[model samples]
Target: MSALAIILVGLLLCLAGALSVRLAVLAAGFGVAWTLAVAFDADTGTTLLISLGGAVLAFVLTLLTARLLFFVGGLCVGAVIGAKLFVLVQGGGADLLLLLVMVPAVALTSGLLARRFERPFLVWATAFGGAALVLSGVGRLWADAAGELWRPGTTAGVVVVIVVWVVLAAVGYSVQRRRRD
Candidate 1:
């Protein structure tokens, strides 16, 4: 992966893990900003500018219209879930039909979940999203180091990654819940 991709992934993991609950509005803002930056294929400098702009926009919009912030957060969370699902199902294949179907479905499901259960949804979504990003970054780094795609010599490596991801996500969730209480 490029340095930009690594940086973006690291920022996402940090936002989701540390700031999602304590500073939910800020996290949501940054999440939306990062998503837009990536979607637009902004260069590093442009991406930074867009991210900062989005953060300010999110903060202002959040204060002016909290519901809108929630909706935006839901949309960002849904998009992340959709992207992850697409990666898993695509598997080096290009199927427009599958993409069309799966993307909307996952996004809608996640969005609805977020709308229905705002606090819990944010907590879990952020944690899982962070974990997913961390795992993805690690996988990409491993691939770069090994000069190949991520095919572990044994299942142990994959298992370890999954375990670590789950543990990290659980820790994030617990920390957020405790803070909330």
Candidate 2:
């Protein structure tokens, strides 16, 4: 059921991206990378490490072209979504909430910070992964607080994901506005 939903999302994303050349390229790149990762059985830590490496590559390549933004953004979003899928398959509700919330939040914050502070790749990598670890702990706390957790939607993870996505989407819009300012 959940697998079907995720597949539907991937299809929709591909369809939407196909409407534009730029989006199509992004979607294709993401699909290829995701497929490779899955085929390789890349675990959560490995995926993060690979993404961090890619982020560094993008940062370095940014010296030549400003197009690194696309790579960084793509890598961050892909990693988050991929990690969430892994959690959903391997872990329970607690793991799902931890990855889903922490991954996007960390990725977004780091990407934004990288631009604002001109930070090193190592800094972004460490901060992002460290934040995820902290959030995982917090998820465990919430799991403990909750009397029982069977399905994710009924648990704290669902609430956190909903709230976080709403807040992040708003923040993303505001950031876009400020960038236009």
Q: What is the TM-score of each candidate against the true structure?
A: 0.59, 0.30
TM-score of candidate 1 to 2 decimals? 0.59
Per-residue CA lDDT of model 1 for 1-181, tens digit only, reads 5734853664454345334433556667777888888898888888877777877877776667655555556667666656655655554666788888887777677667777776577777767666566556666676667311133344555455556657877876777677667
lDDT (tens digit, per residue) of candidate 2 on 1-181: 4434543443333223212223344455555555566679999777656655554554455445534553464446446444543453444435656667666765666556545543233233322332332233334445655322212444466566445434433443343334335
- Best lDDT among the predictions, by candidate number: 1
Model 2 / residue 124 / CA error / Å:
18
Show pairs that collide, candidate 1.
none
lDDT of 2 at 85: 36
Candidate 1 global lDDT: 0.63
Tell me the lDDT of model 2 at 171.
44
Lowest lDDT 10-residue stretch of candidate 2: 12-21
Give the Cα-based TM-score of candidate 2 against the true structure: 0.30
